[model samples]
Target: MTLHRTAILCLTLTAGAASAEQLADLHLNIVPRTDAEAARIASVIAPTTDFTQPEKFEDNSAGAATVRPRANADAFSQASGNMSFERELDFKLGNGLFKKLWVSSPSSTLASDGLGPLYNARSCQRCHLKDGRGHPPETADDSAVSLLIRVSVPAPTAAEIEGYFATMPDPTYGGQIQDFGIAGHPAEATVNVTYSEEAVALSDGEVAHLRTPTFTLTNPGYGAFRDDLMISPRIAPQMIGLGLLEAIPAADILANADPDDADGDGISGKAQIVMSAVYDQPMLGRFGLKAGKPSIWEQSAGAFAGDIGISTTLHPAGYGDCTEAQTACRTAPDGATEVHDNAEIGDDGLTLVTFYSQNLGVPARRDLNNTQVLRGKQVFYETGCIDCHTPKHVTHRLEDQPEQSFQLIWPYSDLLLHDMGPGLADKRPDGRADGQEWRTPPLWGIGLTQQVSGHSNFLHDGRARSLLEAVLWHGGEAAPHRQAVIDMPKPDRDALIRFLESL
Candidate 1:
């Protein structure tokens, strides 16, 4: 189906009744003006170190040294002058085992200490392969089914601090059945999709086709489920330059928080404050669609626990939905509750895995100087896409690291949550974020996601089949921009898409 027709159908189903001019006026002035204010507003994008020159310390300087310290004099001096670009690449390249851990496992493996008694995927790589994009649903069998599940209980009114698991309780097994299971057990769940097709007539006399998804679970292993148990299906997101994202200072992220809609942009960029499992303190979340976790270490660790049933220092337990009748499951240690005999295989392994994921170098821009790409970049900014997809941030200085030293990097995300409206709302709260809010996903290496991750599914869930569909799905703070995109001429629209592909 043509893009214009599909957008019209989507609009017919859920477009707000408000007029265009009124919607445009909303949040019009929310964007920062001067570079200083923009830098302050997007402090998260500021360079953490003065990278114009190498740093010097008063105490470290040797007075009037005619010659540098020899190798025999100080090992530090010998190591300082010599740099190994090859070693740096080796360090940045992910360990083969970690890559295997991210990729090789299935959603149902029983490794005594790994895989899942209950999980969304067997390996981290299964969801986010090569740390790239996932394909959206095309066929019934091939549709993207794995999505993040969220559960929340009411906050306590008293002064007592809740226990770790108290705030977020696991859903009852049958309530949120794992679609895949171990060898002996029945596949606990099944997802069925029914599409309702809508056709729209465009201004150019062309037709656009769109489909709305209706989900149903058939032959559930457990009995009937609760309607109140909110379900959210999130397709895996691309993992690139996450280390730099983690290195961004917290003060920088907070400088951009506009929680109360104070400026009335309708696009309130709120910070989701989450309890960090690693830091053991409340932190401003910068990862996940809702910005639920503060750092990549915790995010990777939690995924290991929740998605792969791998226990680490952070999450020291496993989860499965087996009845008392299932003696083997009941008696057996379903998952690793602590780091086992292999000290190296525990949190250290997870840390290395995170480092690999964090440090996966973003490839250089492709077709950057091309006319189509340049036109697309202009259209991208002119259509107000740049509001959320703010495009550059410099990294903090790394102590003792020569290769990862301060450098300007372009990861097109504001790293803050904005209301995506009902079109994309999963109706589930995560950390401090409301049901409708989602973090603006980074756009670096987005064009190459299909080659790397093997899929083109965009957004939190694999709802949008293509980038155009993904753009059409925008709403809430992005509704005006989405409409503007819809209303653009075919050439302009194609230019915008070409620009996206060039990214």
Candidate 2:
């Protein structure tokens, strides 16, 4: 049986423990259903619905703007000169000077431009290989290639919020901490975790136990950091169909926000509305956990500046932390924002890189027609997993490609925040999201993750070791679905997991 069987039993026992008077007031379905009756019971467990259907996007503002072909027409001609220009542009973006500027070329000097004083990885491709999924560490001592770094403001108490600043102060380490440095300087910091034991009683009268994580920083390279400072760690997410997501109109997203559960479905899909500093407008955020930033342009610019300490048009200032001991780092020239317009290296490099990221195609589905897959899909929906993991969404047309227009896509995510319960909470506030909430991660290309990322870790911090573990770890809003999954027969449970692998 799955881990949830115990949870169901616990609930039953708690329900049974009420006082006689309280029990009299309670309603119960005491008789067990027969096999035919069980099938009827299962029928009520609705198939996972595709929440990304047409109705979800009908109200979007940009929904009315039909995707058009690229503004650059001459580039698509079959002429040799056009082909050559295309190749040249690709070369420039992929491996030329532009690549050197946007991506850190390990062999180049920091002073030569584009390399970093502080960085997580040297290149964009390092974390997101070929724009594919990033796996977590398989073993504790393993070198972390693709990892998520989280950032947050410390949660303010009511008293502090009333007396001082309206919001929590930003950390000295701007958003993220770049642990590795160029050859000369010491690395920024190191993270280590120690676990404490915890126990819980299961319905089978057995104790299923686990460990709790406690984090500590060693050799505080920066000195006396605040104990109550906010911290966020996030793994790099796959980059596919981001442009299509951006094309989705804000109205469509807002239409799905039923924050008060007005639909009475017991599931409230809320929207995280954020102010886009780049666009200078309140936009529906579809990216990031809190959906704080708007477009990929802003996301990329912020990553370059915050992750690598490299400045671009959007972020003019380099990372601003300094100590007397790190004199060389303090002396490095901060990159100017308008370097693209004025310096030899212009925005040409950054633009092409962004294009490549935005255009990385989602691979075609592999096992849709298989019997096991078909059955699994049925099981997935029947178990009510589809309530949140909505299956299909149609992409808006790409202006550049007539062939790629209006394609029906399947990215299994609702892109809404759900309370994930205390087990997953980092206890920090980000934008409009509380500590316990997280965006639903899309489940496309998940089957290929083990092959591409070379690890099985899942979830925000890579805590779950397998898909089963990931499901078992779900709580809060997912508790009901998790229970249903546990109560399923062994064959059906296996079928459901097989269905996930076929993704």
Candidate 3:
């Protein structure tokens, strides 16, 4: 194998079956770090202990790629700070495609036709508003632009069941219930959510209310679902520092995977392995709420097909997610043309969008030196949140991706799957993630949710109304950490939240 000696060392340090060959396949585009470079990286990424002051470069969350934080809703919409002028044009062009709305096919808009026989949103920007996080519908009249309900059934055949990764899409409705459709086609279903509130008393006589949401599909366009149908609700996550996340060596991510919790830290973060859509090999899952997609390219292509019903080279079905049972949808006219590589959003278009997504720079950290923020940072570290919300990672030196190359980034995620317990469970397995398992989402830019997205709803389904509520919802591996917050004095709890907000 052509694996670097340092990479081999990194792999041997981890407990997994990932051979050097598999890692080499994933790092094809990256240059192997030299022994000297590896040593420097080890020292750089080590967790800091000096809480009296902010660590070196703590405010630059994405290193050279970090953009200046904006004062308005466009804070999350900037390109990489390190991107070149020539590349910025491509980013702008990609932004245009990302925001472009598609109409129904058989219209005069040949270049932009093929709006989906069934879809949840018309454009990427529609769901991921202002490049920020998405929220669930706020009221009965609110449109479900960002939040989507996913539907799948248990593997039917014995062989499929034994295969274990064989969770199948619904026969008639397909993988997701698209709430919107083109002019003539009917939508798959209407997603209905009702919440019940429970109040918990914390230390120092403070109370926090948590909302438990029950989701159901009403007004099904296609007939009834299977008896064993499983469903999950997902909201669009924030778009920033994706290229940096992708550049984190798979060996580094795997090294954090303690599937059995052998050391007994009560936190076992398991790697989610999925077959790569582009490379056609088992790769570390990194994007999506459950870390289902392996790369941003695949993730972007998937959203194009699943969210907007626009086909790309990766997902060539012009009818989008229409199942064989939906004859009218399958027969609908698509925007495929020979000039655009026979897909609505061709390879070039998809590439541009992916480029835009990969370069969306994370905003610089705020209030790092604030006394409360610093105290909260100490509280956060002592509380053992770093076990899963790993504070730092160094990206590989990529010959192509200059912006994300060899930089220490603070995404505050292990990118590993952990069981969040029944309280947060959707009971729907996604690839390697069980019902209760969710990828530890990157906490960077979370403080700006209200500033950028105009709301602060969070978690996989937007059930959490505030950062405190989001923490209270943590369970399973994070239950002890959550209890720490609940039991800590109110000052420390407030500081912990302040420290989180500074991120």
User: TM-scores of all models?
Assistant: 0.73, 0.72, 0.95
Candidate 3 lDDT over 1-503, as tens digits, reads: 01110111122223244543445534546788899998998898898888999999999999999999999999999999999998898899889999998999888988899899899999999999999999888799987889988888877552211113568888898888899988889999889889999998999999999999999888889888677889999999999998889888887888888888988989988877766556554567788999887788888888888888999888999999999999999998898988789999877878888888989999999999899999999999989999999999999888778898989899999999999999999999887678999999999999999999999999999999999999999999999999999999999999999998888
Per-model lDDT: 0.54, 0.52, 0.86
Q: How close is candidate 2 to the true structure, as a TM-score?
A: 0.72
Q: Write the per-residue lDDT of candidate 1 for residues 1-503, one digit (tens) a residue.
A: 00000000001112122122211111111222457654653564432233222222211221111113222211111111223545434334334434454212232432334455555676665666555555435576674434544444433442122211223433344223456655555545566656776664433454465556665656756555555555666666776566656654444445456667677766677655566565444445687777767667677777766666566666664443344543443344454423442311365466556655555555545555567666777778777776777665544444533333444456677788888888788776665566788898887666766665555768886666668878887899999988787777777778788878756
Query: Candidate 3 clash total?
Result: 0
- Cα TM-score of candidate 1: 0.73
Cα RMSDs of all predictions? 13.6, 14.5, 3.8
Candidate 2 residue-wise lDDT, 1-503, digit = tens: 00000000001112211122321211121233357754553343223443222223322211222122112211111111112344445434433321343333232443335445667765666666545556544457955556645543554553111111123534444455567776665666676555655554433343334445554445555565576666665667766555546543333344455667777776666655454545443444567655545566667666666556566556554432333445666565544435465321335655655554444444445556667776777777777666677565543333442222343445567777778788888776665567777777777656656655566667776666567667766777788777666666666667677878766
Global CA lDDT computed for model 3: 0.86
Worst 10 residues of 3 by lDDT: 1-10
Q: Which candidate number would show the highest lDDT if scored against the true structure? A: 3
Q: What ordering of candidates by TM-score runs from best to worst? A: 3, 1, 2
